[model samples]
Target: MDDLVLLRREFDAEEGTFLGGLRPDLVWDKAAFSRLEQAMRRVCAAFAGRDELPRWLVEGFWFCADWVPSWTGHADFPRPEPLEYYEGAVERLRDLQSWFVTGESPYLEHHEWPAI
Candidate 1:
């Protein structure tokens, strides 16, 4: 299967949406997160050489990658608040694309996670 197809399957659009700021229907477990991460990585690798990437792909990948760790940190299972927790993932993805194309990594702040 195509990497993009795999990623899209892993990140089901209907399930990804929040209902009244919560996603109770989705499985928020380690196995689910691991599968998402793997699918995202495969998509990233497949698109590394491309001049442009799909916006949904970048946004979905970053939404999970950036928020999952913080969501896991909460003792009482709190839903991830996008307004409060959103890191600039699109920009980071752009930097990653540049690095793949130019073989140069940009300087990152200590707390910033690399897009790849």
Candidate 2:
């Protein structure tokens, strides 16, 4: 069988802690992670499950940068509670996904899988 990685690099939003939640589903469904996903999915679907790794996803992180707002005209980080909560949820979702994808698999590992 071919590797899905050859199809496309895992999606990385280049979203640091600052952009955390924006790319929550990068590892699982790059298409759902950002607008760029639509085009990427279309191109990669043909090669899905075909190689060990794709150029775009050879690295663990798919993206590293996007639009970053400067604090010069803003209130600064450690933002308000509401935004914080939303961001936290987004981050949690990402973490949960990471756990699901890398934690374990039937063919690779099952006995040592953590108790999620």
Candidate 3:
């Protein structure tokens, strides 16, 4: 499947509002957040084990992570807040994309690693 198509399937219009367009005051309801988190997890899983991801996928994940911190809470996993997971996902995707670009096994910088 195409990367953009996969991203679109994970993050649909009805799921959660786009982070790039989200306002600071906007509060997604429980269901909306559930949809968003589910999609994020699915996207993450889809990209797992890949040495490199497409540029579009990295951009999409970055866009979603941009607004994760604004959410109130989640219904599914909660180890890394929604925003945190998305942010890390973006870095992971970027590492993969970088691998494609530079032919390196380890692409992430020290700062790119998620803080524990």
Candidate 4:
């Protein structure tokens, strides 16, 4: 399967925590995390220049950056940093990506565990 496809599936399956929700033993290493970040950047770049973004990008891809620090408490994996692009729509995407990678959501004052 394509890396992006697998990533999208993982992002969706894990509800934006990436591998953070998995067992500690199943957590990904630094290299895998880097690849995931690259994949996310590619997706962000693809839509960043567009005047209007699609619903999937806003509802799905953009939300993939919803990270939870507590989710990684049991794992020692390295976390991804936010991409450096801050132009136009990409800025929002990068902010969301930052939230996922760094547990700092620009839209919220605090990080809370999602209610189940």
Candidate 5:
């Protein structure tokens, strides 16, 4: 299978759940890959031929981080409200998803990664 497909499969779970928690391979951190593929598919469908989006956009697809959450609400709490790094990620993803759905995005690139 292609790397992009494999990455999307890693994130193919409920709306808000750990990607690897529900996967057979236990692989996580694949959301970026999925987003890129979806955008590519959309662009292709819209054009029905060579779209020629941009080099930066296509290359941005291979971006994301393997985030290991480390946060507990209380002494006995099972989990925290926002896992480390997840909160910011969720925010960005929300905007990106919205842009993708509307196709009137302000995002310069199709793919995006958290700034270093």
Candidate 6:
């Protein structure tokens, strides 16, 4: 098994908090979230069932930066609603790219993995 490195460090709380602030409405930005979600699904499918996936990439996508309350069934965050799940997906993918690749090639190009 190979170690899956993170592309970059996690966003500091300030950065994450700032990002959470950008979408203040309880309603999600569906279009933008869809695009980000599709991209992340592709990435995750590419590594599906692989234990090499790092904790941050997995947890960030599933739980998101703002979904803590649902998992805990409490209003854990200071926000009125959960932060956009797909935003966290995008952040995770970006970090994954930096972790494993170089240059201008697409992320899948870095590995010999088959098309998902």
The most accurate candidate by TM-score is: 1
Alpha carbon deviation, residue 108, candidate 3 (Å) = 20
lDDT of 2 by residue, 1-116 (tens): 13243223334334432234433422222233343322333333343345443455423222321222232113433333355543433443344333333432223323332211
What is the TM-score of candidate 2? 0.25
The TM-score measured for candidate 6 stands at 0.37
Tens digit of lDDT per residue, candidate 5, span 63-116? 222222222112343432336544555445445434434454445655554441
Q: Estimate each model's TM-score.
A: 0.48, 0.25, 0.41, 0.43, 0.34, 0.37
Q: Could you give candidate 4's per-residue lDDT for residues 1-115 as a string of tens digits?
A: 4655756665565533445444445443444445555565555545444556545445554444333333442345443432232122234445646544444345545444221
lDDT against the true structure, each candidate: 0.47, 0.33, 0.46, 0.46, 0.40, 0.40
- Of models 2 and 6, which has the larger TM-score? 6
Worst ten-residue run, lDDT, model 4? 81-90
Which parts of model 1 are misplaced by more than 4 Å?
13-22, 25-27, 78-116
| Model 6: how far residue 33 lies from native, Å | 1.1
Single out the weakest 10-residue window by summed lDDT for candidate 5. 64-73
**Which is superior by lDDT, 3 or 5?**
3
Q: Model 6: runs farther than 4 Å from truth? A: 1-23, 65-116
lDDT of 6 by residue, 1-116 (tens): 11122211222212233223333433333343444434544555566545466656555544443352243233443433345543354455454454322223244645653221
Best candidate, lDDT-wise?
A: 1
User: Which 10-residue window in model 2 sums to the lowest lDDT?
Assistant: 64-73
Tell me how many clashing residue pairs each candidate has: 0, 7, 1, 1, 0, 1
